[model samples]
Target chain A: MLALAWANLTHHKLRTTLSALAVGLGLALFLVSNGLATGSIGEVADRMESVQAELLVLPAQENMVFSGGAVFTPGWTDHLASVADEQGPLATDVIPAYWSQITMGGQQQRLFGIDPEQMPLFLGDRGMVAGHAFEQATAFSQRIRELRATADGQPLDTLLDDDEWSAGLELVIDDRLRRVGQDGHPYEIGDVVRVLGREFRIVGVVESGVAGRVFAPIETLRLINDGGRQRSTMFFIKLRPGLDHLVAARLFTEQLGSTVQVQPTSDYGRRLQQELGKVFMYVNVTNTLALIVCFLFILLTMYTFVLERTREIGILKSLGVTRRGLIGLSMLEALLISSAGAVIGIALSFVAQAIIAMRLPLLTVELPPQHLATAVAIGLVGGIGSALYPGWRAARLEPAVALGYE
Target chain B: MISVRNVQHNYRHNGVVESVLHGVNLAVAEGEFVVLMGPSGCGKTTLLNILGLMMSPTSADSVALAGTETLGLSDSARTRLRRETLGFVFQRFNLLPTMSVRSNVALPLRIRGQHADGAVDKMLDRVGLLPQAGKKPGRLSIGQQQRVALARALIGRPAVLFADEPTGNLDSASAGAVLSLLREFHRDWGQTILLITHNEHLVGAGDRVLTMRDGRLHD
Candidate 1:
């Protein structure tokens, strides 16, 4: 019976191939779109968790974490350091950081301004991929603060009594920026980048996707905000290695009062992932529609095939083939076609991943074996289910009328 | 053996009733070779259809096959009876075009849940189609296709073989060859055959010949 079904399908080569192609196309679209959705969301979650700090000092206002993130003053960095745990300090180290969007060479890039002395504490030696780390001098930071407080840039000479203070404006760019400045102009370690009318030379380029693509001194970011602003967006609290962040988060929230928000790192990752999930609803809808279109394509193809084979069905009936046998043959035919199509779709998905890598570099797609199995299973169910009606029609053919059909 | 009495069939077209067969009676003894001949629009094909159980009569006084009453059998019962007792060769040969010649011959046995067990090869060999067993019916000539149909009909060793103008679409040489093969089978196997044709030259090959007209058979 299976042999007969196969022969019949192969006999009508063009029709069978067209139907299989329709099924393959549907499965391929379904796989590629879903993979893209999951991959893009996973990338965002990865980048967010890459931050060095395990504790965030957000604003006390609830839901403000996603509203351009919660902002607080750089003064909070001092308070966090002043607190104590059973160990020497409540937190191992503290960094006052500000994230601001700045256009470099006509493209927006994330600029993280951290205290230069603690760049190793945040990013370690990997942060200094090229050139050298910032020189460890307390006066260099104090000089930038004094210069930023004054209304005019001329106060910088008076504030910086030491000639070496001029070197404090050095920048360490992320490797992502070193490549092409996040799809903008390429930059070397010694290149100069101007942000908000101030020039800072790149002293180092860090690995991509680990830290911010652009890094400057905290006082420099404060100056970019406006003279005498003196405020930072948030305070980053780095916990001791192997220390529980949850315990430190609770300690900080209790000691800092309810006016400040302290959140563990894991919760932030979850919340951001939830945001990405909300954005993926549209892709899910498209995947559903694509599968439906695939189902309809197969259904129409099988129906027309049965119509064309009506006379053959009648002949089989006259040859003493039972209705169940006839129906079984049709279903077997459809299943074989569907199974072959799903395999092709699986192969196509691999090509889709490569295409995504080559064309949409920012988006990553992971086509796990389980995902491929799911696509194949759906194709089987869709293709076989679509043929049931046609099988019934073929089985129900009247031998008397059909034998007479031209 | 086959028997039918007062069997009538009707067709309703455009709200008008047309009687195609009226109270037709037929009986062919076991192993008897019978030929039925008639002009177009006669009830010869209808009678053959009833004997083969491919069509149910609107009403029948009595219908029995192999001494068993088959008149009121259910549809599945009728299909099983056809599978068990009857084999047919139609005007167009009716071979599945996509199937190999041997597969076509083995189909009925497969449907009966019985392994063909070399019966297909034996029948094909008898029909001189052994070399072409693996070829599809479409690859064969019309006469070759009809012989494959003939081999397929007799492969199950059915009790009765019904040939309804089996060579109607063939050239004269092929028709004569088919009739000769039919004669050889009857002579060697004492196989019962009911052949229907409008060709008078084919009538003499049967042990008994009859003509049908106006919904009735004449001796």
Candidate 2:
């Protein structure tokens, strides 16, 4: 039976080819649309994972830290620390961080200032790629502190206690600025740089694995920003192990009052993902409309084939072919056309993804196995469904009358 | 064997009734070569259609095949019986132009769920056209194409063969060749053949002949 159906299809090569092409075009559109949507969401998740923050504390109503323009008051960090001390084991440590724009190498770069001692606690031991982290015993509260007692006549402690000792002063910059430095090399360790009229030694360079960003010690940032009396833009917090993030978030929000917002880090990532998902959904809907239009075009093409073959149908009926057989033959023809189209469409999707990825490095279209299977199934159903009415008309034809006509 | 009693059919044009066949009755026995002779619009093809189970009578008293009444048979059943027990040849040869002569000859067997490769070879060979089986009907002479259609009709080894002006479109030489092949099949296989024609000269070849005028069969 399949052989017969195939033979019949090959008998009219032009018609069969046209019908298959229509179905193939529809399948290709569906695959490319879904790949783009999936790729967009995946890119967002990847970017968030690279940031490596356990929790992001922000205002409750803010949607995005960068775009929402959220600001934390100067006293907010002190108030959060007090609340953490009162809370049980669920509260770990909170680090104050700020994001600001600064002119560097004739380009505005985003600067991140973090507490040097607490940074390693959250970012792990691989802190600075080029220089060492700040020494823990260094005096943080006063301008100068006495070093280990020396065996000199005046005693080394008195000399080290003077404010002139500045060897430990350090700053960190990102790799991007290193490429665009005035001397063809960005600041390295022991290199003094001026920022906001304050001189600081470049003790290290850090690679955040993100583009367009720089990092500096909190004390040095305070000096550059003319003291840390003003608020910061972002904060990173860590919770005690095995604590329910939602419950901890609720407790923190209640304690901090309405002036600040507390959110679990994962939840923030999910919200960003959802925003990206909406954009993808819009594209999906547009593709669905295009698919419907393609289906209609296929219907028109198949209908024309049926109309042209009315006499053949009549002859088959007169030869005592069953109506079911006729319908089966038509469906088989549709299935073959659709299957061929689906395969071609899937191949075309890969090609399209490659082309798009070349132009947009961040956009990587991936065709999962599920997406391929779904595209083929949709093509088959669409082909068979569109062919139903015409097949019925052919099946119900009266052989005697049809044979009588031209 | 086939029998019909008081079968009537009509055509409706804008709600007006125009009867084509009225009170038509006839029978043809197994292995009997019968001919239905009539002029144009004499309802010969209509009766043949009723007997072939291709169309149903509007006011049928009784139409039976091999002792079974056909009125209760569903459309699909009728179609199956036609595929299994009957074969038809038409005036125009009616060969599928896209298919080779062998495939055209094997169509009825193919429709009956039989493998056509061997049957097609044997049938075409019997018609002395095995050498030309690869050619399409359009490439064959009218006589050869008619023989191909006949081969198709007889490939299933049906109980009866119905030929409606089977040689009508051929020249005299081609028509003679087709008639000779039909007679050879009838004599060799003892097949029951019912042929319809407007030409009266061919009636003598049949074992029995029935004439129709004004939609009723006569002696």
Candidate 3:
């Protein structure tokens, strides 16, 4: 029966191809939208993990901690430090850092400020890939030493060295800094980058694994914020081994008494994800409606195909073909149409994703195994459900009347 | 052998039930060549439909084929009987247009779930359409398509063959050729054949002639 159905479908090649194309377009939209929705959620989780912070501290009144940008008095850091120092059973180290977006070299980069001296304790064996750690005693020693060894000694390497005498600002750009400037080498360590009419020397280049980011000294970041020195935007704390992040977060909230929002790393990330998910819910809804509409279209078209072939069905019936056999044949036809559509749609989606990735590097569209499985399941369900009414009509047709039809 | 007893049929049009076959009874023995002759509205086609098992009377005790009773059979069982014991060639040459000539010829075999190996070629050859087997029915002449339909019907080796004006759509030459082939097959194989036609001139070749008028068969 399936073999007969297949032959019939192929017999009308043009109509079959057109019908398959219609189904394919609908399935493509469904698959592409689902991939993007899942990808956005995954991207948020990935960004949170990259921060490597066990706990996050933000202003208490902040409803959306990830997006609203934490704003609190710099004195809050001192309070958190004192609380950690005096703790007996649940003592932990708290590191305070400030973060904000800044425009430099005509591109937006996230700026991070950390106290050089205390950073190693938090980083702990995680050293920089490029420059050495900041040394306070000989803070200006390496620059002066390298400058004196140059042939001219005329302060020609002034931007690379001499951060104290030239300006207190220092820029730590990411590996993507390679894209800027004529030489395609946008101001390496000790070179100057002008931001908002202020020139800052690139004291170091920090290669954070995630792309499109930059970091600077705490003092330099304060300068970039127009002398807002005492305030910090975020406080990151690392817990001791075997110490639960939730326990540490609870201690902070208890000590602060709602003066700030204290949340574990995972919880904060999840909250951020939830906020992002709200924006994509509309997309999911629209795509779902589109898929439903597509299912209906497939049903209608396949039903019409069956109707148009009524005489043929009648002939088969008069020839001793059982009702179940006829139904099976129609279902096989439906399945062939659906499976063909799914394969074309999924293949086109992969191609589209690849093309978009080339244009937008950050857009990662991956069709996982579960996604493929879902598409196939949708096809099967669509095939069976769409064929039911048509198959029934064909099965119920009386051969005598049909044979007499013109 | 085939027997029909007191069979009646009617058509309803806009609340009017017009009787077409009124308690008609007829019989044809094995190896008989019977021709039914009638005017357009004389129920010739309706009688042929009943004889082919394509329809059943509204009220009747039995329409028997060989030794088995057909009136008590279920719809599917009747269909099986028709498939195994009957073959039909229609006036319009109702071949599936989407199918090739070979496929159309092999349709009955396929429907019976029989192995179609060499069956298509043999049937097409028997109909003298071997070279045109790959063409669709729509591409063929009315006579050629009629031959394909004949091949499809005869492929199952049915016990009784029912033809309703089988050459009505053909040219005179094609029509004569088809009629000659039918007569030859009937004579050579000793197969029972019932032919319905309004053209009384063709009745001379049949072994028996039954004329129908006003919903009754005349001896």
Worst 10 residues of 2 chain A by lDDT: A141-150
For candidate 3 chain A, the 10 contiguous residues with the lowest summed lDDT are: A135-144
Per-residue C-alpha lDDT of model 3 across residues B50-155, encoded as one tens digit per residue: 7777777777666888768888788778878887888888887777776778877777887777888697797788889999988988888888888888888788
Q: What alpha-carbon RMSD in Å does predicted model 2 have with respect to the real structure?
A: 9.2
What is residue A98's positional error in candidate 2, in angstroms? 8.4
Candidate 1 off by > 4 Å: A9-13, A60-66, A95-97, A101-146, A149-222, A226-236, A257-263, A267-269, A276-280, A305-307, A402-406, B5-23, B39-51, B55-64, B67-75, B210-219
Cα deviation at A68, candidate 2, in Å, is: 4.1
What ranges in model 3 sit over 4 Å off?
A64-70, A76-229, A238-269, A273-284, A355-366, A404-406, B13-19, B56-61, B97-103, B118-121, B131-141, B214-216
- Compute the lDDT of residue B155 as modeled in candidate 2: 88
Measured with C-alpha atoms, the lDDT of residue B84 in candidate 3 is 86
Tens digit of lDDT per residue, candidate 3, span A1-406? Answer: 6657777888889888877776777677777777776764565455444545577777777654243665666576668765552445343556566676667545455566666655454344344555543434134333433554563634323335444634445555544453353234455565666654557566655443331245555544544463433567777766666777787788878888977887776674577667667666776787688679778877887787777777877777666677777778788888898888788778878887887655443345658888877877877688777988898877876777776554
Please tell me what DockQ candidate 3 reaches: 0.46
Ranking by TM-score: 1, 3, 2
Supply DockQ values for each candidate: 0.55, 0.39, 0.46
lDDT (Cα, 0-100) at A4 in candidate 1? 87
Chain A TM-score for each of the predictions: 0.77, 0.63, 0.71
- Candidate scoring better on lDDT of 1 and 3: 1
The DockQ for candidate 1, computed on C-alphas, is: 0.55
Query: TM-score per candidate, in order?
Result: 0.82, 0.71, 0.76
